[model samples]
Target: MRYLFAEYVFDTDRRELHRGADVVSVAPQVFDLIDYLIRNRERVVSKDDLIKTIWNGRSVSDAALTTRLNAARVAIGDSGDEQRFIKTLQRKGFRFVGAVREAKEPAEAIVADDQVEVQKVDLALPDRPSIAVLPFENMSGEPEQEYFAEGMVEEIITALSRFKSLFVIARHSTFTFKGKAVDIKEIGRRLGVRYVLEGSVRKASGKVRIAGQLIDAVTGAHLWAERFERDLADVFALQDEVAVAVVSAIQPKMIQTEIEVATRRRPENLTAYDLFLRSMQQYYLTTRESLAEAIRLAHCALDLDPRFGSAAALAGDCHASNVALGYTNDPQFDRKEAVRLARLALRIGDDDPDILSRVAVILAGMVGDSEAEIELADRAVALNPNSWRTWNNRGWVYTMAGLPEEAILSFERAIRMSPVDPLLHMTFLGIAHALIALRRFDEAIVALKRALRHNPSFLPACRGLASAFAHLGRDVEARAAAARVLEIDPSFTISAHIARSPKSPKLFIEGLRKAGLPE
Candidate 1:
């Protein structure tokens, strides 16, 4: 690849330089350094970026990088004294100043076999476009609360995933770089994403504090950031409050992005409501113990304000979790309680997307009412088209209904809206299942691999991959994959589980059988 400058050409493939027909030979490292500079010519290429990219994350002395840069300058017919080709910023990085143009290509076609690349969808970038919600750092100094922080990120991921107009990265992909110091541009390239959100969370002395910032990944520029401090007594309100603020911040940034007047209504006071937000955060933990705490806090929120739609919705969510996780001995009683709370939430906040979505999840997942679930999900999406969770929930409904193609599109849209959510690995699994049903075995395998890349422990993805390989006549790999799935969830019985869902189609079962599952 030749990067063009006014009179100079940096040939990446040839590892050579050309200045108006004159060949300039430079050290390999020097050529790489020059090429890097030219490719990112519009902005400053920080030393950290150069070291990471050029050295492949290896440690290299700053003096060595400086030497190669100087050598590059000389080869380009520029002197350090004149400083015309490259400009070094004080305490920052380097920039290429010269204009570039392409040189001649050698007509040799060299193809490598081991390179497997997925073709990206060709879609127009939406106005006020992309975003990333970074994992909120746990400032509470309690490592155990890492789940709390992670839960917050997940909620944000779900909330944002609803927006069809915004592009969001899957949470699993973003969290892969968690705790590591990374350059924003590199994140953009690796994830093929454009925006990033970073933040920190602190809980101490009965209060929770959160600080967050949104950045343009391509330019490493800060677009928005804010800090919120609230009492832990109102913890359940935190996620929704934060989500609302984020949605507010993102709208103005999007091209022709307008916020609806009806959606802008705010509670008179949020002190009690804040506790509800914090409680809802705990609810997403989806564990037996956490559900107890979530239910307790949600009731406390109702005590504060019976009309609080968010708290009511969270109460419903807690109940749904109990049934989903098999926490209750009486499935019928548990489901009744879930349906009751969900219906109450809908009655109180029928127009609220978050509440509508919670009710829809219960209807689809617990009640097995796909038609009603789809109706609610569609309404929620229409109300808050920017919420990723809404789309994700809709995808689940489609999958349960055996509409794999519709499910695949819904999941894809959810990923585009909030690509960084950890649960998105399941979305990939859903896509694989859909592809298998469509008899597109190769595409199914690719989607499964992508799911594994995001979450190696995702059992559904493992099962899907095994089934895909088996269908493709790769029995050994298929058996190995199925074995892994069984290891993860020993009680996993494909036939029994499929039978439980009335909407499971014969086509889907056939595809799974071809993939190697035992009848």
Candidate 2:
């Protein structure tokens, strides 16, 4: 039988695989592994199964198996990061996830290899903003300056990629047009990007100049342009300056333009980073289904790259958030998983501010208030004060530490840092919590209302509204809010909620009782 998938034809009888006209070379073991995976595609294939079948029960180290699997992926235009063909399930096993069609006869019988052609892998744009940064022109006329010019473009690409909202073509793709006089439109179309960033770097007389312009490839209109010059000693600083300027300038313009960017949305073909971004978007939706989907996608990303601290942290956050929002039936299991994943993320990315903040938040929420958590959050914010997530996590640490005033201030800073963040609801909820702790019932209600505006079905906001209304002697509204909470989270009970939030104000608990919530 011949199996066909993603422009690749695998002829089992011939023991060969062909991608369009190209025959993909695979080691004997790797080929067997692929064959096993494809045959067992209906179910996950365990390591033992592979070792028993492919190796005839011979002992194989974990690393050896991983290398073989990676080789198999590469031979088929798949990758560990994308896992488009083979998927790894944590603690379960591996499975072939690609869509495949079967051919009873050999593929060579239908068409010759020379007549076959594969569609470009990146022919379609992603469902978000996408851009490509071409290599900066090295105008210095010195070969030594080439690295610096290339480095500047790389720096900008890295910074822009961190935004998660933007789809950045890899350096390998954009560098192909390095010395070529390619039109911006051609570059965009070839790269499947809506925007193209072109720049020039010149170094002379102990100084360096870097100029960059962002252009809408569709219309060939320059969206934004800036130039910076600095001492040679400050080249790294200049790179950072240019990156920050481009990031700050481009995002707002993309938002204002409301660029209808995507041409194709292939959820199954998402890379690890793409899956992470999708998980984050689901997380920001703040719904029970969304949170569950977020965890699933994060797990897939984690499986693709076990060392991906961001994916582990995101999965941990989802587990913690489920408990926080009363979306969990098994709190103990969720709590354990949340703490374990947080620590894993910490071990992998202790120095990353985003990971530190994420771990800190998970620890604080799942493990309760701790001095270590406060320090972690503070360090994260100190490392990246510009990140609203770091500031938001700092706020959470303080809230759990019983510093309501300080927590409120930190939350306010987070809001200012990202005024239009999709995660705004969580920040607003943090403010509400701090205000409630301070006995500022009216202000707390306003903050809770704002949170509900972002996520109408947010159980925590509904619960907060119940307490705030009860405190204000608005019995009807209090009961209504309490009902909403139960509607959103059927498992919500006063005692369970109080146990989860040990730091809840006594009045808040009393109000829950007054609002007729289950004891």
TM-score of each candidate structure, all chains considered together: 0.45, 0.58
C-alpha RMSD (angstroms) for model 1: 25.1
Best by lDDT: 2
Q: If candidate 2 were superposed on the true structure by all CA atoms, what would the RMSD be? A: 9.7
lDDT tens readout by residue for model 1, 72-133 = 87887564543445866555577775534343444121111212211111112222245556
Candidate 2 lDDT (Cα, 0 to 1): 0.78
**How displaced is residue 306 in candidate 2, in Å?**
1.0
Question: Candidate 2 at residue 155, lDDT?
Answer: 82
lDDT of 1: 0.66
C-alpha RMSD by candidate, in order: 25.1, 9.7
Error of 2 at 397 (Å): 1.6
Q: Model 2 over residues 1-519: C-alpha lDDT tens digits?
A: 887764567878889887655677888888899999999887878889999999999999999889999999888766665455686765667889665667775465533444322322323444456788889999989998888888788887776655434566666557757787888886666556778888898888888887888898878999888888788886777777667666656665553343122113465666776677777777777677988998998999888878677889989999988788777777888889999999998887676778889999899887775899999999888766556788899998898788889999999988766676677889999999899889999999999999989878778888889998998999999999999988877777888876665556687789899898999
Off by over 4 Å in 2: 1-264, 267-270, 499-505
Q: In model 1, state the lDDT of residue 345.
A: 79
